[model samples]
Target: MEHREAAFRKLFDLYRHDIYAYGKSILKHDEYAEEIVQDVFLKIWLNREKLDPELSFRSYIFAITRNLAINFLHKAANDARLREEVFYKSQESYNPAENNIDAAYYDRIKQQAIDILSPRRRQIFELSRNRGMSYEEISKELGISVSTVKNQMSAALETIRNFLFAHSDLTLIITFIAFGWL
Candidate 1:
């Protein structure tokens, strides 16, 4: 174990800066580059036993770093697209007088959508969205696993989205409002 630890430490020291540079060059962001470096090193350490010392560690490590950086960019792009869709839908449905909708009316409809959730799901959704708490924070507060919180939130969002789409004249407007776009 000691020998393995020493070797891993040496490998980390040798490749850490190079990995950071590669990530920064590809990502063009300091924090994201740092995250890539950390993630790559953590993965390497976790899979140290599988590593072949005879092989070129440089190539292996760089390949892992590259793949992780690309995946991160892909997820970031998807998130941006979703945000834009939500914003666009909200703007499209936004007609105060034409739709005969006021803030209080929207609020009531939003509450009704939330009311459709099961009791536990409603609590988790409110804590996460309304209170602006992170899944980790909600998990700690509610004594539930983070995965449970995430699952419950996802279900809650889907349920609310479906209910809003079904009941509202405007398309996905309630979804945008429930998600805090309005």
Candidate 2:
């Protein structure tokens, strides 16, 4: 374990700045580039045992970094499209106050959506979202497994999305999402 940690640390020290630079070049965002760095190193560490030492590690690591960066871009593009379709293009959202729909209304819609969740699911969602707690922190606090916390959080979000879709305006739903109520 110590040997593994030492080697991983050495590889990280060697590649982190290069990875960050390459990622920033592709992503054009500093925070996402930093995320790419952490994700690249994490992937490398998890798959270290499978690495072919005789092969070019530089080529391999860059391949992983590029793929992750592209995937991030793809996901971001999808999120951007959602914002475009649901929020920016909507006249109602553009003048929400004129329409008598504001942050408080969005909060009400969010609360209604959240009310549809089961008790345990609501607790997990609130802990993770409202309290800004990490899954591991919520798990420790609730005396539950981390995976259980993750699963419950996923389900809670899906339930809220469905509820919002069924019961509220798309503008309200998107407004909550745009503001990261989910």
Candidate 3:
């Protein structure tokens, strides 16, 4: 047990930032990167007793981080596309001069899409995507059936797709749609 703890701790110290940077590259958000790194380390620590010392812990951690990063990107991209669709559909009044604030516009759209998700659905989506929790893990954590998790994920994907297709061209929609399929 002591050796396991030590090994996990060493692994955390060695690769935390590299994993974080990889996560940031995928998520493009410092806070989300921090959260994902911490979650990966927590999982490693929790499963340390089962770890094989001879295997490359770095590879294991990198795999976990990469999976988490990809999930976060999918969720974020879906959320972004959904918001853009909603904004266009609503015909919200906007200042023509606001084009100068491109970053603000993007942020607002992201937040709006996130806000549109139900609280539990949003949390589940975020956890599954950003933290790389599998269906079983998420089901256990949330006290829901795996079928429910799958249904929620499908709903999330569908909502994003329907919203995007309503506002964007087929090409842009299809390109973004590929992420969900993948």
Candidate 4:
């Protein structure tokens, strides 16, 4: 127990600053950035049993921080005042050097996950997510029922979640939910 506590503290110390900077980069608020730091560490501690030392801890923690920040942005997206503030700030370019994260790596992973889907399923997923088409719009365009589109989307998300589980941490799964898929 003592050793575990020490390890946790060490992890926190190593990550807190980078997490704070990244959170602030996305959230555009100091208070929320600080909250992200606390939240990230709390999640790490809570899920300590799932830690895989063989994986890169830096990437894992940053993924958690990113998901938490996105969750905040989604909340802000609902507020008239904060929506612009958070969304605009989130568009600012992220410097991977500052956080020691490889943004390109994650991008490839996302594309790879999408690439794994069947041609039709991938088209439905992209039309809904990338093109921001409504189910009715896609159904009309593709001559398919909305129910089919909904099912394909759900399956695509599950496939993405499964790929992330195999290749990364739980962050991307949370990302699907945090992106308002819920």
Error of 3 at 178 (Å): 7.1
Query: Model 4 segments beyond 4 Å from truth?
Result: 81-133, 136-140, 143-182
Q: How does model 1 score by TM-score?
A: 0.44
Superior by lDDT: candidate 2 or candidate 3: 2
lDDT of 4 at 156: 92
Q: Candidate 3 on 1-182: residue-level lDDT in tens?
A: 78867866777788988989876654445677798999898887778678887998778887788666545545545787743543343334556676567446444544455467788888777777668899899999999999999999878765654444334333233234444432
Candidate number of the best lDDT:
4
Candidate 1 local lDDT, 2-76, one digit each (tens): 997898789889999999988766555667789999999899988887999799989999889867865664454
Ranked by TM-score, the better of candidates 2 and 3 is 2
Best by TM-score: 4
Q: Model 4, residue 83: displacement in angstroms? A: 3.8
The C-alpha stretches of model 3 lying farther than 4 A from their native spots are 1-6, 77-181
Q: Report how far residue 120 has shifted in candidate 3, in Å.
A: 40
- Model 3 worst lDDT run, 10 consecutive residues: 165-174
Query: lDDT of model 2 at residue 143?
Result: 99
Higher-scoring candidate on TM-score, 2 or 4: 4
> 74-114, model 2: which lDDT tens digit per residue?
45445976446434444433653455646666668778788
Task: State, as a TM-score between 0 and 1, how close model 4 is to the true structure.
Answer: 0.56
- Tell me how many clashing residue pairs each candidate has: 0, 0, 0, 0
Off by over 4 Å in 1: 1-100, 171-182
